[model samples]
Target: MDIQVTKIGMVSCSGEELPEGTISRIACRKVLTDLKPNETVTICLPLFIAGGEEERKFAKKYPTITVDGCEKLCAAKSTEMFSGKPSKSLVVPDILKKHNLSAPKKLRHFGDEDQAAIQAVADEIAKSVKEVLEND
Candidate 1:
């Protein structure tokens, strides 16, 4: 049988909306869509308090991809703590730097810069997922 793969997003906080154009959420969605139908993706926001146990069980049965929005590494850290090892990790800042992009100063609100950043990160994640699936 093929290994089940799960894509998970771990954000720092749960209440605030992501800056406009930030691709973190969208990139996450794209990654989920790109996965094989048998695969699963879970977006574990900070507010999610009840499903950790179920998620933990599901994670053990699949390859999990964790995407972190900033240097804080919230998502990656959480996944490691919960699931042991994330199959892949996509860090937003690293993606931005890879594309020579800079975050805006007033990123407290969503905007064009935020969108670009999200897209860059999303694109990288989508590509990574494709490669993994293909190789498997």
Candidate 2:
């Protein structure tokens, strides 16, 4: 016998001005394509905040993880306001601080150091995905 579970929703900041925002997006893609392909779906923040879309509707019914690029936490805040609080929340700055990583300074291009930070964020998100799947 096999039991199937609903996929986790991922909402990440889309801000283009910050490196953290870029990191958030890349990490989300890693989770979807590499880490949790069979167990996750990407939720578009622009669609969710813009009013009408299937992503928001799907998020309302599933366990969602919100990834924020900055302390402002637009992704988490929007998810909470439109649906409910996310099942898990990740902030790039906080993660970097916890891991003793310096924040990325460039937005257009990333160096090797930034790649390391991105990898750390992706790893943590993948771990959270595992936790949510197991608990669900």
Candidate 3:
């Protein structure tokens, strides 16, 4: 017997140089690991861009949500360029502004102070995942 389960592909920004980028990655980790572990899968931006067959194929076959840490939108753009347009795209700074939260300054290590921003971003990513699933 073969059955298929619908899954949402999550792509997080690869911008490690910015604090927002770190926040984006952390948020995505939470969503993949804690928030939507069973419903979502991570589509790494670097590996996808490097032409990973599995990553590209999955993005092409399933709905995807992109989380961008900066205005450049590296994750979303790359996903669109390599596979197809993401069903939902989220920006970290915009998410913070929308939630009335402050971004953490630490680029490498996050403390309790960064929890709000991290949680907000993770929540948004989880929401996006749900949205894509519902639409599918």
Candidate 4:
């Protein structure tokens, strides 16, 4: 027998101004595509905020995690405003600080040093996915 579970939605902030935003998006893609493909669905921030009914409905029905690039918490705040509260809110900068990793300064293009931040954030997102699934 196989038991299937509902996938968690990951809402990543679409901030392009800061490197952390780039990190946030990259980390989320890593988690969604490689780390937790079976456990997560990507919710486009632009669409979610632009009144995407499907996105909003998915958030309301399933457990969602918002990954924000900075302290502004754009993804988290927008999620709460449009849909409901997210199960977890992962901040890239905070995660970096917690893991003692420095935020990558490069924008569009990243260097070898940036990989640590990406991996760390991806790991955090994957970890959050597990916790939310377990608690669900």
Candidate 5:
């Protein structure tokens, strides 16, 4: 059976500036496309805290993948607290640490090193998602 997957990201303070090359988005798309046709994927951003009830309900019925930037792990924590399901959490800080990268101060000011780090994170997440979906 194919399981639905949800990709969630926490909000960054920088207005109008998204952290470039965050694998959260790319990994999300990869999982969605690779999953069976019956499966569905949704991207959730924490900027709007309101419509979470509906999201929580959906998550309960699906396999949610929560990607958190930095050490906050907001997406993963919120998924577990509100959705009541154990989410597959990808902590960006942990990935960055593997590559000896320092966390960026602002989302908008992502340098080449930051981009590379994000790409590595995204690639790993995509691999994990694919493995889970295929094995299910």
Candidate 6:
């Protein structure tokens, strides 16, 4: 039998209203682009929530990580509802709290210089990706 191992699926929040959401999205991109280019993939929440089966299908077959923006954990909840529970779930606010960092004042505009929170999130996400890939 021919078998294939899928790449890690990243499901992030679609919250455009919160800064943490932006951070979550950016961090996921950073992982996909810089950290683990060939080992990870992202599923757009809009499509995932719109009854799109592509993301659901991928999640069902592979380990997925839900990157939630806040305590609501919309991404994680959605992933669980549509597919199996994610292998790992990360909350941006929780990461910031762990690092004793404050969120940016603006929700949408993060200057290049003020990337402490973004870096924190990206780094943690990268670490999680490494762990998942290693276990795979």
TM of each candidate vs. truth:
0.68, 0.92, 0.94, 0.95, 0.62, 0.92
| Per-candidate clashes, comma-separated | 7, 0, 0, 0, 0, 0
Candidate 6 similarity to native, TM-score = 0.92
Q: List the residue pairs that clash in candidate 5.
A: none
Better of 4 and 6 by TM-score: 4
Cα lDDT of model 2 by residue, 7-104, tens digit: 88889999898999999999999988998888888888998899855776777778889999998999999999998889999999999898988768
In TM-score terms, candidate 2 sits at 0.92
Model 2 residue 129 lDDT score: 85
lDDT of 4 by residue, 1-136 (tens): 1213569999999999999999989999999889998889899999889999888888888898999988999999999999899999989889999999988767769998899889999999999999999999
Compared with the true structure, the alpha-carbon lDDT of candidate 3 equals 0.88
RMSD of each: 4.6, 3.1, 2.2, 2.9, 5.4, 2.7
Instruction: Give the per-residue lDDT digits (tens) of candidate 1, residues 1-136.
Output: 2233443332322213333224465666655565333444555655333456666665555556666666665666666776666667777667778888876555365576466766677677767666655665
Comparing 1 with 4 on lDDT, the higher-scoring candidate is 4
Error of 3 at 65 (Å): 0.5
Residue-level lDDT of model 3, residues 7-122, one tens digit each, is: 88889998878989999888888998999988888888888999998999998888889999888999999999999999999999999999998888778698998899999999
Off by over 4 Å in 1: 1-23, 33-40, 47-51
Kindly report which residue stretches of model 4 are placed more than 4 angstroms away from their true locations once superposed.
1-5
| Winner of 3 and 6 under lDDT | 3
- Sorting all predicted structures by TM-score, with the top scorer first, yields 4, 3, 6, 2, 1, 5
Clash pairs for candidate 3: none
- Please, what are the lDDT tens digits per residue for candidate 6 over residues 18-107? 889998998899988998777788988888888888778888888989999899999899989988898899999899999998887788
User: Which run of 10 residues does model 3 get worst, by summed lDDT?
Assistant: 1-10
> Which window of ten consecutive residues has the lowest lDDT sum in model 6?
1-10
